[model samples]
Target: MKANPKAKADPKADAAAAPAGSKKKLMIAALAAVLLLGGGGGAAWFFMQGGDAAAEDTPKASKKKKKASNVKPHYVPVEAFTVNLQPENGEQYLQVQFTLQVDGPEQATLIKDNMAIVRNRVLLLLSGKKASEISTVEGKQQLAAEIQAIVQEPFAKGGDEQDVTDVLFTSFIIQ
Candidate 1:
């Protein structure tokens, strides 16, 4: 059983017999490197596609915005109306000022031309409301909407209809 002292230690054999912790650390480092490279490649691919897609969509979006910007709003003022409201406990009254929002100047002109009929309809609607009915915010909003709908209707037979976008109550008072 004599030991051979001249035998050289093989490096490959030493590495194969490395401790479990050392092997685990090496494997972890290699896995981390692979994952980092894979993640970077995936991110690069995604950004390249996203950039190209955004570039392609930009012109169409800009054209739509330009078209939307061409449409303008027109506002027409209406004279104040003081109507005797429906009596609740006593005589009630409502004084309201109106401004009509139209799609364009032409629509505003049409509304102004038919202002008498519009005023008559609005006065009738207002006179029918009780003081309590027009006191709340919701009631006022509903009244505005109703007025808008009525004002938008055609005033005469074979007449072009006016587009009343909204009825704004500049002043609303209930007594």
Candidate 2:
């Protein structure tokens, strides 16, 4: 016996199966896209935000520590004394006493060793100045800076291991 040329078709069942399979494939593809995008965004955020924050944070921390380090004193029992300048050009005499603070023993030794040379140089510098140079606050500050530089240069050059902290005019009498 020969089979029939047209068999009866079950349209409803085939149609249902086709739609369900397509729906499942669509859901899987959407899930994969979401995961890929989320992972990539998270990785980019980690690199961009975290790197700069770490870089900026380290310097701020070190700068704060450095500020504290500067607050610590390296020397005590500061030296103070008077030095008379050589008279010049018929101007009145200048007498100045300096209170100096230094950072270490080597610096103290260098200062002691070079005291006379320092004094002589200071006297010379003072004598060269007009009375007006010592008369104003700005001028006096400049003079202090000059004296500090003069006193420190030799010690620095002599390889003393520390710095001269400051030179203060404890007293001044210009007559």
How high is the CA lDDT of each candidate model? 0.83, 0.67
Model 1 C-alpha lDDT per residue in residues 12-123, reported as the tens digit of each score: 8887878766989999999999999999999899887654556545666675344334558799999999999888888877889989988777788888888899999998
- Give all TM-scores, in the order shown: 0.61, 0.49
Badly placed stretches (over 4 Å) of model 2 are 1-90, 155-162
RMSD of 1: 10.0
Please state the error at residue 12 of candidate 1 in Å: 33
- How well is each residue in 6-119 modelled by candidate 2, as lDDT tens digits? 966689999999999999999999999999999999889988764455555575567544443345433322343334444455547666777666755655666667777676
Q: Clashing residue pairs, candidate 2?
A: none
**Segments in model 1 whose C-alpha atoms lie over 4 Å from true places:** 1-70
* Error of model 1, residue 152, in angstroms: 0.8
Clashes of 2: 0
Q: Candidate 1: worst 10 consecutive residues by lDDT?
A: 62-71
